[model samples]
Target chain A: MDRQLVFELPNDLGCIEGAVEFVLLRCEFCEEVSRRLRFNFRVSLAEALANAMLYGNGGDPAKRVRVEVTVESSALQARITDQGSGFDPDRVPDPTAPEQLHRPCGRGIFLMRQLMDEVHYNDQGNAVTLVLRFQDTEALLREASA
Target chain B: MAFQVSREGDVLVVDVDGQLIVGNRQELKTRVLEELEKGEQKFLVDFSSTGYIDSSGLGVLVSLSKKIREQGGELRLSSLNEDLRTLFELTKLDSLFRIHDSREEGLQGF
Candidate 1:
């Protein structure tokens, strides 16, 4: 199945949950991946959504967050775009910094990298795309159907 | 995060359970600060049963830590699982606060 859904939501941090649920709904519809894949998908998608809401809009509620999901033969691609001027994704501090451990924030990208098969960003840095494989799509479909 | 509080001598131990994400951030912030304002400065956050927390939750912890330190007291965390501890270490927050293996160790501070 090949399809895409684009959403323009206010850049409020609260919208992250709704975006995650939206992805989950798609996974349920695909019915082709396993519980592990589902968890991985949720975590990766949540990180992208969080980035869109936090940095994309500068945490401004008035801005807009755009998300698009495309399902393909071999992979699932999700793109999250935000309203701000964009940023340098390369500069995100490594959460593993020895001096930064107790601080409590700034690990979304780290977790996202750990969960998704591959993660990349567009030149402008305002849009991030996450790719997931369909290695066990048949099993996912059967499991979801049953 | 939903919290249940109890006092042990001069310390106020807050048992925060549930997902501490952006959605519940405000509640956690308000409640923790409220407890501190009521003169319960020495604090311990027991996450023994808490399973998840996001950046926003971390933000609250930072804010409270600053507030508590400003009041000439301290904030300690206890019972952090592997994942939660990873999050802390990843952000390098492990160096900022005092962490203990158990509630007793955190409370006694001896």
Candidate 2:
């Protein structure tokens, strides 16, 4: 089975938790995605949404963030678009670097890349797509049965 | 998210409940700084009841860790659930901060 969700949320941090919960609940109904996978996806989605709201839209309530989520038997994907002039993802500093470790910012993009199977950004950088593929679903089902 | 603070000798233990995401991360940072301003140095954040944390939450933790260290103090964490534990490990933050199996162990170190 395949499912999809689309949301246009304001640039408000208060809405992030509810959006994350909605994604996780949607994942629960998809059997092909395991519990562990759902948890990981939740984390990645949260980071992406935060980036769109805080960095992309600068938390402007007038601006909006658009999210599209698709869940299939073999994969899950989310595309987030923000209404601000985009910046280059390449300029983000590596949080793991010794010098950058203490900084409180710049970890969101890194985490989105780390947790998701694939992360892509548009040229303008205002939009990002996150993908997670599930290979060998039969094996996963068997393991769950065991 | 909500935070509860208690003191064990010189260490201030913060028990966090609910999701640690963007909106509430600043509160966590501000509270920690407030404690720092009070000259309370040794810090332990208990995540037993915390179900979720994003990069913003991790950033706050890193910031608090650095702020505490700059003040000649230390920050420790305890009781992270499996997901958060893996997050810390994936980010290699496990190497940056001291993580304990329990609050007692964290307190013992300070």
How many backbone clashes does every candidate have? Answer: 16, 0
Reported per model, the fraction of native interface contacts reproduced equals 0.47, 0.78
Residue A16 lDDT (model 2): 81
Tens digit of per-residue lDDT, candidate 1, span A1-146: 33877777777767776777776676665664654355566666767777787777778877887888888877788888887788887888776666555455667777777667788888888888888878755656668789
Candidate 1 regions exceeding 4 Å error are: A1-5, A29-40, A60-62, A72-74, A98-105, A133-146, B48-51, B69-72, B79-83, B92-110
TM-score of each: 0.73, 0.92
Off by more than 4 A, model 2: A136-146
Q: What lDDT is reached at residue B13 by model 2?
A: 92
The TM-score each candidate achieves on chain A is 0.83, 0.87
Candidate 2 displacement at residue B81 in angstroms = 1.4
Q: Which candidate should be chosen as best, given TM-score against the real structure?
A: 2
For the second chain, the TM-scores of the candidates in order are: 0.93, 0.96
Candidate 2, after superposition: displacement of residue B2 in Å?
A: 0.6
